[model samples]
Target: MSTTPHPPRHEPEPGAPRDLVGVGIGPFNLSLAALAHPIPGLDTVFYEQRPRFDWHPGLLIDGTRLQVPFLADLVTLADPTSPWTFLNYLKTRDRLFPFYFAERFHIQRAEYDAYCRWVSENLPRLRFRHRVDAVRWNPGRNLFEVDHTRLGPDGEARATGRTHTRAVVLGIGTEPHVPDPLRPLVDAPDVPALHAADYLTHRDTLLAAGHVTVVGSGQSGAEVLLDLLRHRPPGRERLHWIGRTPAFAPMEYSKLGLEHFTPDYTRYFHALPEPVRDRLLAAQWQLHKGIGADTLAAVHDELYRRTLHGGWPDAHLVPGVRVRTAGRNGGRIELHLEHVQQGTRSRLTTDAVVLATGYRQRPLDRILADLDPHLRRDSRGRPRIDARHRLVLDPAISATGCAVHVQNAETHTHGVGAPDLGLAAWRSASILNTLTGREVYRLPGRTAFTTFGLDQLHPHPHPCPQTPPARHPRELTPLADGT
Candidate 1:
């Protein structure tokens, strides 16, 4: 037998048990990372394909706001009294004054993204650029066999490595889906067809042309169309925005509508049979599924402003119309349309087509491909998952002692709440409890506040020993004035 010594284990501490390996680093997984790190005896590591935090950067329109309220940040739902909460972030940044001045629960998408990065930076628990390729069950040891492909700091692929995890959480995010008609234009040279994800990156290239055509009626489509129309680079006619829907419907927003995003709704939806739940979600969450109210206002303002200019460049809402076909000819994309209501047809040739059709869930091929025969799949051919979010392994693989959990793939089972920040903290705590067979971090009011964030909300936060720094991290020393 070989006598090579292994590197130090990445466990929490000596004799600490291994818990979870989160497969993605989006806000959903990042929130889980934040909550899991504070747990004393659970060893958890989150893997991300990207080098750093990037949440829908292309969709980060200049004036777009968050869909959920600001209080629905990473840790609050799990621990309302947790220090790492968004409220605590506001306090640390000293923006609590400005934040309160706004008098709304929502925050700008940019600021929210920056806050996520700020929270991520202070926590040393996440592992970036580590993409999970596959997971297998080794039932003999009752642990998961994970194979990961990581990119080095220099942007080169490092050798694939192995890590053993008691449970695995798959948080692979969504992939952008564009219509078939526009697919040809995407690859053509100088054709300038793109998706909303590439909007900001390709703005200048698209703006160089005389006119632009933005398709789809969702938030991204509306935002890109308005931005192009309002901010014309030097000289240009108004941009053309086409829609399949009858009109641009602003997202539904109300106190009760907001509850549809809560964990309670999640449990309610999860209780229904698979097919019925899917139909209910599609009907109710349409507008709630897209942009927020503030963004609609900005788009309306721009449209109104252009109308007052008198010399309105040809822009048509063209309700009840859908694109029959799109072809690039003579340096222009010819869009043939069908008016569903009138039963008539028309065509528009434009410089470019910006598709905002949205995205689909990333596939589970590379990760679970090899073990295809040893795993159960749902009726729709997706992995059949358990309540704890673990993948039920086949008998052959079950003998190897492994269990795989999920982090992001839950639309069919858990509803849209699967990818939300609302459940991250609680989910992490649950996974930790399951893996370690004990409560790792005490929930607020579960016991008593003895740690950082929660304890501070008292007369003076925490053990009567700490106080808010005078200028927010300006002084490194402890405060004597603290109770």
Candidate 2:
């Protein structure tokens, strides 16, 4: 390993068991850390393998904005007064007045990334460059053992450490998902095919290509196509955008329709039978998978602008098409495609391909392998996450009061809101409340005007207790003022 010294480390006291230990330091876990900071005695820490925080660095296009509003920041939705809010970051940076004048409800992606980085830099109880290797319930000690490796600047393991905690949270987040048919092309270094996750890294090479193909109709694909169309000459813009959907649909953004992302919906979804939940997930793609209306309009406007000169642009935007297979055609790429509705097959040759196919939850088996035997899986063999976000473990593990929770890894148990930023603060607060076994965050009684199910006619709102029960030594520290 290189001799470069590691950055400053923030770790819990040695030999003493912590109340909570978070496995991954993504936005979800970062939110948890921020919410846990003000509490006086909740000893907790988070770990991330990355050297620092970066939220979709490659897709931080110059003008792209977050899908949610600015209030849905790391801590604002949960506790607006928290010093770690996005507005606080702006105030500290001396940009609050300018932000007010800008009248922007949704901020740019880069600004959001900067806000998160500021939180990561100043937030206590965070350990970057620490890769968690395994998690197991140490029955002898009645605690969970978290084995992690501290890495040098170059990502080489420099030291190994074990942390003992009463509870563990896994927030490893997602990974880019490439379709099987196109995986070979994307994996081969010789081919120019790449996932949209690395769009900016090889953007110049793509712009120089004679022709480019974007293979997904989601928001990312739309953004990439719009960027390319704006850069290329009008009427000569040779681009192709295709997906399996019947049409490039806009996201469900109606006031009431958006309630699908509410906590009520999550509870209702969890109560659903496994098969019903699977079917609902399949039919609710537009709720979370479609392109944003503004993005769709921008694409249309750009294409329309190019046609004003009397000649149509040489761009083809097709749907209901899927790539059956892809291969290297000499120096170029050849894609074998089939149209489901039309029952037709064709071949297209392109100089470059951008797979905008989205992401999937990073599997937890690798890190939780040791605890697999204790985990209670669903009919589909996925971990069974309860309504409180805790993994349903064996009676032996539960009897010890040791719990394992997950973030952004419970769509099947929760709902589409599982991966949404708007729900991050709520989920984090919920996890904290569950871990402490008392109402620490004081969650909202009702978040949506629409009742998710008929059974909730008079939903008994179990808002966290105004005053936490007389705190036991093992209980967590509740927010004092109950703000």
Candidate 3:
């Protein structure tokens, strides 16, 4: 004789259930997001403050290709078999054959960003336009209670119900960093001082005025200045490119130099001591610094051409110069520059000033504010990160059994490769491994940053493109060798 069993009841409203929560949805956590998507019964939700995926959009200058190789794409570094690799994107567009024949080492930014969006749309786990407000440890359940505010349908603000998670990964990226001297002029009316990110939207106005002054020596400054000089009507405006460095810094991209961008190198870098790591970052900044070969060459060509057709307001390269002060002078920006090489100071009246200084990590204080007493800090007041990339909190939060893991935001405590594309896969996999408590460590020698061997996956082959090969300038050493 068999006994009858009752059917399980379901919720009538069908509301959201509690499980795992990911704080930020940048590329780092997105990589983990793709990994977590297929796991069985793993209810995971990721929150992104931005409405969509945008990586370095402001400086996606025309013909500006990626600094790293195609192998460093999102899924490629984590799962070679994944459908979202750069090679796979090319294949989907039927450009694989042409891409291989073209023999290009780098992929274009437009395509890279597009590919990331495609992956994001398919993930279905990401909650867009949502900002995490706070994370609290629930003592009774021993789980992470997360509170976030997300935009409801029709763009109106709605307070969504909270969810619980065993772990959380924070991958909030960096922001444009401005200097102290020009802080007041950030958005001043009529004065026109802005970061390079606003260059595209503000370009036409600045070009129409007359003189333009660009600050910083990194990729954005170089490219913005180059664009202004080459694109502005023949003799209308003067361009001033100033930098604190004695010379324009060329990005080091030799075969061995590029090893630092590889996972093998990042693992080795993370194993070093704190002081040694500091010394290494200072030494390698030059290797990882500044503009791409193609942009640098374009700047050189335009400069030379303009010199031949010389006149007033042609273009000026002021190296070893720093902006000491800036103010609005008769509806224009009057910048005081200290010519470091000559030990002399000079003034330049320009239509606009752009600060292209680099970005810094987004502080975790905003989201982690409520849990201040429970949070832990490292020797330098930085978040102490463990091998699994979990934040080492006070008392290690053992009684609660909750862990706060981070994704590639460990640069302050770890090293440079923390936020890079090279380690996306490895970091995601490690976090998963920790969450599952499984001994599966797929990527060899994994650290808080960098993953190895996923780019070499043989399962998915590159698809060919249908379009004709892209037209490039004369084959040059800078674009190829980059030495």
Candidate 4:
């Protein structure tokens, strides 16, 4: 709502490369953009394929709220005094007093989306409708070359251009993840199966169906099922909610349990062996992937209300179930499901299926395909991401000091905090610090009460000196005098 005029679109000057060029303008890169806006001489630009910023548009259901608190906005966690904080947004709309009185910690998802859009509109150097085609290192110029296609309002390519930058940040975000067994049905035009990412768009159709089955038990699944339950009649609500977990469990929201998302935990997780890190990520799903307790309560409350003076609500809430296969049976859909715990199989014929199986990190190989040879990879064929969130590249590229940072795509390397919104600002600040070679926003050295490793307990043991000995290089040789 500020009266500042929109800055003109950026065009890279010939023979001059920018300090950084960000690809994909999702919340992560948007956070980077907001944090970078105040730097005195930092030259940065962010691009997105969409016309404007819209975070999970289809999942922004009414009454649905973010799991994280409002203070975990794009800039507040890293820089509360910044003009672009969420509080300032309310002030711009003249609703600051109302928001202050509301005393709401978790804001609605729609409001969060709107807040991001507001930042997207006001921030300079964001070029929407620009699709980055490829990225490659120009050995001759010692810079990264980015190729992009400019799309018109209709989404057709209108022109193509290239830009040069000393560093790059990839924030393309995630895509709707449909399970392998249900992929065919979701891909077919006639099938009713759709991922929860498009839940709002097809809510009306789902409600009109005779029977609807919601798959997966994450936060999205709970929200969608609750929405459908609220709309359907008490006895006629033929809804089924099933998932792979043992129960529709609540997320770990306890005070100390929440510390896993802190910078301290991220550093600890990063320092562990690669195999251990991989095993830990697979076992820590409940930390960030479970349903919120409030949402679970709402679901329970709705079901209990329906049973006031009648039989049950014709709803089946089952966990430990997985969809083995799915197909179209005339106008209906048939889902072959298995109970992981009971080892039982059943065929469910329903009018619709919503796969809230959650989202996977969109692979970056396509965008960085041209630079594949230069990127270092793990045994699993994944790129090796460093503690600073930059992709580990070959020695030749590293020698140039040109970095390729990733946003929301480092779960395998940084633990559950990688994709979390609560850590978005901190991660962005960290990246900017490395990119600018200066502390633009001062960050805390430690952010948790719990010491993560054994070394913290025996800092100076009986066998070791009270004062720590000076550190030496890993390959340091003994002195010539052998003293």
Candidate 5:
């Protein structure tokens, strides 16, 4: 036997054009990298500005579990036998037996983060601390140029480089959002107000405050409130939870309800009229934004337990309330609130505030600005994303066999599952299939039992209209469904 080491397959030399270049190293892109590793002829690289892989580090509170099952990992849904599966990570750590005995379907968020970090450490061609600056399509070269900055350990730019690729995938994730009324306070370092994304960082300061107010009724808000409740004294707990929602509703997690995250639903959603899609997205907030039933139950049980002494805890949980404005009052925060139903207004004075207003998709225009002129948009001025997750670009770019794909940025076109973990593997698989121009990962023909539309009663792909109705620049094109 010859004793020789083989070079990595499809490993491009420095400055050589690559098959794919991924902009962000989030879980979605990590999934794509893992699935692509087994392929023989695909040269892929992923970049992330962070020093290492971390998924919601501040919100990974103790006892908080993932909403999805363990099967919704980086590669299991697409290829269970892949060595990068979460189960394989457990096996490598000699914890598979313990995990099996524990019978945990949903793992803790911290554990999931550790698992992803493990994968990031082991995976090849994943460049951390590298920030992608811009992406431009070089028509003459028939390649996309990716400019990136390599940062030092302290996050200062140390070096700059560029790479050329046939295609690019962007997985730039969401950022924490603060309501306009509370943005000024959150931005002030002196004020104790902050978004829940930084909860753990300022947790001790928040607990030390005499009064703490959590704004929002979503899962993060509930989780923060529950954590605060558990730490504070029951009788002296000065807490307030307020939001615009009517009530702290439980998330829609029924068996049939989850089918909306399936690929079948994604295709159905993509084929709908643009106006209908927008309305559906607005109406389906509860599907993804509501609190988990168990989390809500724990909150209520904690509150109820404190009431055993015949006096209610000094915690106020109010809904249907909106914060009209906020300001500082003698080192304390004052929130001007309004009750929507009663048309009543009130003032709340608290020492600290936690804005759990959730996150919004990071805009792609910054990186893709160079190619913006060649990109097509929908009636709402958003990029037109096809069913396969590729941005619909001008023929000048597409004719050259170059494409720009997106992950987690297609909620409007792909439905709420765009940011969902359960759909991560499937979406990665779909993108891979499209990029390779072959059925690399044979996906399921039917993933949901519920037929989304009258025309979709039979399990077959629907034919999307090639051209939309003509309309003026400021008007909407009417559809048959009257959207």
Candidate 6:
């Protein structure tokens, strides 16, 4: 690994170029960095716009636990022996024994965030507070040129530099999404409407309000509502929770249902017809979007506790309702809502609104505009990602041995596991294996017992032994010499 300090611009040595230039320092890319750290000859660097690592800071409420098990950490799933594992972090903090005695399968969200921070701080190759401005293919040098601006304490641009590398992996992550109907209220400076992403910052003010409404059915919404309910008085607990789904559903936690997040299922989903993939994603929202069973129970218990006082608390839980429009009343917010089932309209006035509407994939078109002509697209204009997670590009770029890889942005192509924490280590290993042209982490041949398709079981009978077996365009294949 190499570090270029304070130079006006970074210039790669005549014979040495970075093996990979990671564009974002989120958990996925951080996993790649940790795995690549011990490799003898692989040179890599990661950049992040923030000065430090923090995952969903505002949503890391007290007692909120991660959906995945602790084993799904940065390096555990792919390489349990790595020093960057969560167990190692606990040992360094002198809490290993306590953790073992706790008998906890799932850790708290704040602890997970802190574990990632420890990894980021110890990793030498990470360049934080540097915003990547542009990425372009340099035909003459046969490499990708990455431009970035170094930021100071106040986030001002202190300097600018460039790095040339053989490959690029984008782990830009996602941003909180606010629905269109309620955008105006959130945009208004005087209004207290905000997204759940900023819940912690405004929690006190929200709790003090006359009425608070949470608008989503996911885990975040449940957590926020539960927190508010616990702090308010019994009879005066004026809270409303609404969502578009018919009922507050528990996530699919059955043993077989989790196979959807395995490597085999990812491969199967990638090979299906594009339209079929689209429809399946729309229908399988509960797989990754529903609230966890434990969280649902907690919410119920909190509400149930409030009812033991002899009178029902001033709380309303409604589903199958959508916010049509929102405006400001004298000192409160007015929301126009529609019932999806009855097609009836109603209005509700609240002091504040929390839009827990979830997040969308951050678009890559802006940063990849220079490479637009070389990118291959699907019918819906989405980038066509191959089984190896590399964006399918035109022959002109592919032939040059440079690939553009994406992380946490392939739900459309890789199924519901795209943004899952459990798949982070495996995905990073796969990308590293492809970049180094060798079996870096030695991934499992089969991760699930369920056969995704019958054709996979019986590729061909004795009818035509000599004929070649059919292969999907997106099927993963080992690259020769990691070129």
TM-score of 3: 0.83
lDDT of 1 by residue, 1-483 (tens): 211212223556543335778888877777777776656555777788688888888878787777677776877766666656787777787888988888977788898898888777776657788877788765566666778888888767887877777767777878888788767777676778888988888888877777788888777777887778767732255477777776677677665555555554565566667788678767765534455566667766766666675765455555467888888778788999888878899888888788887787788777877767777887778777666666777766544444676776777777766766656776666655565666564433222222223222334344434333221223234558874
Candidate 3 lDDT, 1-483, residue by residue in tens: 111111213222243544568888787888887776655566788998788888777777777787777887776666777665677667767888998999988878777888788778766768898878788877677777888887865656677657777788888878888888777679576677778877777777767766888888878888888878867866664778889888887888666566565555654565566677667777766765656777788888876676666664467787899889888888778888898979999889988787887787788888887667776775567766775687777674744556888876777545666877776877787788778776343554322233333332222122432432332223323344754
lDDT of 2 by residue, 1-483 (tens): 321112334445678899999989888999998888876568898999999999998899889999999998988888887888898888788899999999999999999999899889988778999999999888889899999999999999999999999999999999999999999997898899999999999899998999999999899999999998988988678899999999999999999989998887898899889899999999999999999999999999998887787988999999999999999989999999999999999999999999999999999999999999999999889999988899999998888778998999999989899999999999999988887887788777667889765566563434454443331223334556973
lDDT of 6 by residue, 113-165 (tens): 99999888888789999999888999888899999899998999999988899
Per-prediction TM-score: 0.82, 0.93, 0.83, 0.93, 0.93, 0.92
Q: Please name the candidate that would achieve the greatest lDDT relative to the true structure.
A: 5
Error of 2 at 176 (Å): 0.4
Off by over 4 Å in 2: 1-12, 459-483
Backbone clash pairs in model 3 (N, Cα, C under 3 Å; residues 3+ apart or in different chains), count: 10
Tell me the spans in candidate 1 whose CA falls farther than 4 Å from its real position.
1-17, 233-236, 285-287, 309-313, 395-402, 433-483
Ranking by lDDT: 5, 4, 6, 2, 3, 1
lDDT of each: 0.70, 0.89, 0.72, 0.90, 0.91, 0.89
| Clash count per candidate | 15, 0, 10, 0, 0, 1
Residue 322, candidate 4: alpha-carbon lDDT: 92
lDDT of 4: 0.90
